[model samples]
Target: MAYQSLRLEYLQIPPVSRAYTTACVLTTAAVQLELITPFQLYFNPELIFKHFQIWRLITNFLFFGPVGFNFLFNMIFLYRYCRMLEEGSFRGRTADFVFMFLFGGFLMTLFGLFVSLVFLGQAFTIMLVYVWSRRNPYVRMNFFGLLNFQAPFLPWVLMGFSLLLGNSIIVDLLGIAVGHIYFFLEDVFPNQPGGIRILKTPSILRTIFDTPDDDPNYNPLPEERPGGFAWGEGQRLGG
Candidate 1:
């Protein structure tokens, strides 16, 4: 009975979030079991271009180090914000969400080439949080019950926390940069005086992932709330 309940709960996670989070956990598990090594998973330009190890491109964003506090921390934020974004702003628009993932990943990859970073999964998580916070600007956020801020500052707060931990802030910054570029393109620019929509979800993706019977009048998330989840009511961020 317990196993059945757990399975049902797992099934409730939105599709894109479910798949990505599962991949991250399974990749980490594979490493923990000694089935794979970090050396094989970290992004390598020469190995990818010359040796044709294309799997590295995706695997690099799967493993988030060992299954300790850092790993758990990243997984929590990744799962929560990814699910919120999917079930909120991106609801009934699975194809567009997938496109956002693709767009973010592409930009990160291009940036990764110049930086000496290996694993990008953490940065990818930050990007999701960044985008979600931007869309729900009025949603209040609390950081580990210590700080309170509006949605737009969430990404920077996260970066500050990373700095406090002595970790490099480059990954977080990269995610923020990519997230802002995407946000400006998808949400900001098109609404400007003479700006036009620059990013369009491909028809093929819509055919493959979108729901055909989406309600025309449905609003998954309101402008001021994040899919009905309360963030600053004595709950810890990422809890």
Candidate 2:
């Protein structure tokens, strides 16, 4: 009975979130089981270009170090924000969400070339949180019951928390930079005077992943702030 209930809950998660989170968990599990090593998963330009180790590009964004507090923390944030974004702003727009993933990953890969970072899964998670926070600016958020703020400040809060833990702020900054670039291109710049939409979801992606929604009056994210709250009500960091 417990297994059946868990299965139902798992099925409730959006497809993109489910797939990405599962991949991260499984990759970490493989390392824990000695099936793979972190050395094989870390990003390396030389191995990728000269030795044709192209899988490193994707794997680097999969493993988030060993299974511990840090790994669990990252996984929770990754699954939560990814699910919320998919089910909220990107609702019925699977292809566009997938496109965002690809766009962020591509930019991070380019930036990775210039940085000393090995794994990028945490940065990718921050990118998701940043994009979601931007799209839901009015949502009230509580971080670990210590700080309360609006959604837009989430990435920074996470970064600050990372700094408190003595982790370098470079990874968080990289994610925020990529996320900002994407947000500016997709949302902000397109709405400015004489600005045009620059980041378009590819039609092939539409055909492949997007299901046509027939409702013409559909609201991807309805701004219903009952009791002065948004979709993230009663949720908090590490809760």
Best by TM-score: 1
Model 2 shows how many backbone clashes? 0
Prediction 2 TM-score vs. true: 0.89
State the lDDT of candidate 1 residue by residue for 1-239, as single tens digits: 99998986787777899999999999999999999999999999999999999998899999999999899888888888888899888888999999999999999999999999888999999999899888877766766667888888988998998999999999999999999999999999999999999999999999999887865544332234333433322222443
Tell me the spans in candidate 1 whose CA falls farther than 4 Å from its real position. Answer: 214-239
Stretches off by above 4 angstroms in model 2 are: 213-239
90-201: candidate 2 lDDT, tens digit per residue? 8888999999999999999999999998999999999999998888777777666667788888899899989999999999999999999999999999899999999999
Clashing pairs in 1: none
lDDT of each: 0.86, 0.86
* Model 2 lowest lDDT segment of ten: 222-231
